[model samples]
Target: MIQSTDEGLMRLALREAAKGLGRTSPNPAVGAVLAKNGIILATGYHQKAGQPHAEIEVLKALSDYPSAKGSSLYVTLEPCSTYGRTPPCTLAIRDAGISRVIVGSIDPNPKHQGKGLAELRRDGIQVTTGVLDKECTRLNAGFNKWIISGRPWVIAKAAQSLDGRLTRPIGESSRLSNSHSIRMVHRLRATVDAILIGAETVRKDDPELTVRYGPTDHQPLRVVVTKTGMLPIDARVFVGEQDTIIYKDRSWSDVLDDLGRRSVTRLLVEGGGQILGQLFDNYLIDELWFFLTPRLVGGDKPTIGGVGVQELAGAPRLVDVRYLRLKDDLLIKGDLQWPKNPSRAF
Candidate 1:
């Protein structure tokens, strides 16, 4: 049995956890709330990797150490029992004199999975698990994927007309998304570890691909995958101050493998049809974000190119579909139904 109060507190914890999404790589964003007799005492969230976790943040935020005694703690993710970059959170929770713990999701890492709860129970503290489990799990999908598969979570995004045309037949660069959508794209870029594009996009668009709409501490690594080693010498990508990497004459798998090794937990792929085609062909895409405008551009240029599905059964489908209106444009985002390649899951 679960209480509405518990659900509400867990939801707040989840909201707090999301604040650290872009900043916490190689670590899941977690939030915590301390409450006594249905009254909230303190709230905190994890800020970055190798820093104090959510449990520590909440405990330290308390005005008095004795205030947390016999209070219930609600957390989006389980407390860690082992030390890595910081001290074990379970020990801290016990030391704080917390009487009960309500958790949203268990630790995804095998080494710490369920161990935290076991240690707390051994100390005679009451523990409740799986409060808003689905939401908690989805919040850290990128971290979970990176932890389990040793690869980044791939997000394929594009802006096309209603008729599915990326640009004019001449392949000239044009703005299909509105000002609001462009801002949204910039915000999305801030949350990812890297931005990837095909060679053709570099030659045609010559995009700088920096986060300009809002404030970001660091620019994501710019990546370009090219079959041939030829590219414009003065492309903006090359001239930009941000770190850039060119994968000339390399397979998509090789590029992803190297990026994974570099600890890129979330990768955004902005495309020029051919690059998107390669991703789709390789079944490398985990999520899709398409901005569809009201106007239709009837042309031979499709949003995605490459040998597409020959039969209806072979076509890919999206799950957990979401549609949002960004000004006049429609943003369609969803996860792919099929599992990504286990070898190169980025």
Candidate 2:
């Protein structure tokens, strides 16, 4: 185990690494920090694909530091030693005169994996692994999932009333989540590669569905699912110039396969209940974000419309549930553990 002080630096590196969540598809987000004499000299993270890796950026930031030799480097993922879109990060670190390296998680990409660490050691640099490793793994869940399973990690988000009603009435458009919770949902959208919704949601709410909470140059692609391809051109979803996709009666497998081929690492499903059910029916959802509002919409209201299971045992179960209070709203988050796919079980 690394010292607690070094572990703390690794945690900072991991946090910086997640800033590239939506931008770095087909590339694992990595963060690197250079420290000397118990002080962080500079920190950098992989911003997007087809660009320099974290170690190179950090080295460039620290190049002007006087007497920077023997500075230690802390990186969230193992540095790549082989060339691809950019030069090897290991070469940059060595040239920057970093003497020791600490890695939070080992890279599993086919090009590097264990070879990056081996290359660093061959160059007579000190190396330590597994510093804040669990958190680092969670940070790279989508990238790792896509690397192995060929499907983006799906997260389904729903906000319902205290009585589980998705809305007060069937035809009316009303917001169930508070302002705080709504922004939380938008932030989630900003972090994923795409946001999916059913045609009914667009027809009813006409939401802009753009990221308005934080500084973001890129927007998540908007995807609409419909039984037919017919949609109003004047709808609010089409008002913006962002890329949008419509799928007519496409199987969940087909949609997922297409996204995987595009290297989409993460997807967010903002549901109108039936869409969530459709994903569940196809066994595609991987995580669940259920928020319960403070108010109760109890009198003959539609509660989770069109969601059903033939038998009790068929319902998807939430494991590792964590509860928190967002203002007055109750937030429940967990892993959506589905039955294993028989064909892929082995």
Candidate 3:
């Protein structure tokens, strides 16, 4: 059973873990807390990619104090059992002498799936799971999706004026959404692994694509999808070779292979409409997060995606729908429910 104090500490850990977003690329944001004798001892959150994990940092923070031999540990995700950029977190937890472990969610990756829990139990540590399970899963949805699926989770976002136009007529500069909504967009950027846009968006907006607010520790990878690879060399997103990925009409297998090699787990697609249509047409998208404002712009500019289709007679279907009201805006989130046979076209 989890005590109220335990739940409170876990909430603090989750909030701390959220701060590591945008910086902890290729690593799941994790939070850990140690409590002994009804008193909290140490807390830590994963900060960046290729660095020590949350468990390791917490253990280190408590090094000079009393040992954790009889303490309880609360973690956002199951401790890792496989070694990657850092050592397996299970081994570190054992070394800390923690008597009991409470995990929020299990790691879905096959390599270290149940091994971490099994190892802790074998070493005589009492382990409990599913504390705030849904919340933990929601926080790490991107990492979970990547571990289960081959591709990244897709979040599609757009902002438009009261007239529903992303930009003014004749390509004039205009503010699509207010400052509050724009701030929320930046917050979304802080949580995802990557932000993607089409070549046309790059040519027109030249977005910096970096986390500009809150903690500046991490930034998402900026990606552009172009069939002919016509993106400008000096675009703000393309600061160097490492910061950008240009998706061309290459072999599908090759593209997947490259993405695997790069360890790209989650991908957020911010669109100029045509790009969204292309991804949907190719059946490459896994999930969709849509933010629809209450205002409507009846113009010739664009509506989400510009690929003018006469009808949705043969389009993919949404499997689920969720709605959230943010101030005056309506966020309609939907998940694509592909047919039983994935290869079959709608």
Supply candidate 3's per-residue lDDT for 300. 65
Candidate 3: count the clashes.
4
Deviation in Å, model 3, residue 284 alpha carbon = 3.8
Superior by lDDT: candidate 2 or candidate 3: 2
| TM-score of model 3 (CA atoms) | 0.82
How far does residue 216 in candidate 2 sit from its true spot (Å)? 3.3
- Evaluate model 2: give its TM-score: 0.91
Candidate 2 lDDT for residue 261: 86
Pairs that clash in candidate 2: none
The reply for model 2, stretches above 4 Å from the true place, is 63-67, 298-320, 339-346
Predicted structure with the largest lDDT when compared to the true one: 1
TM-score of each: 0.93, 0.91, 0.82
Candidate models: Cα lDDT each? 0.87, 0.81, 0.73
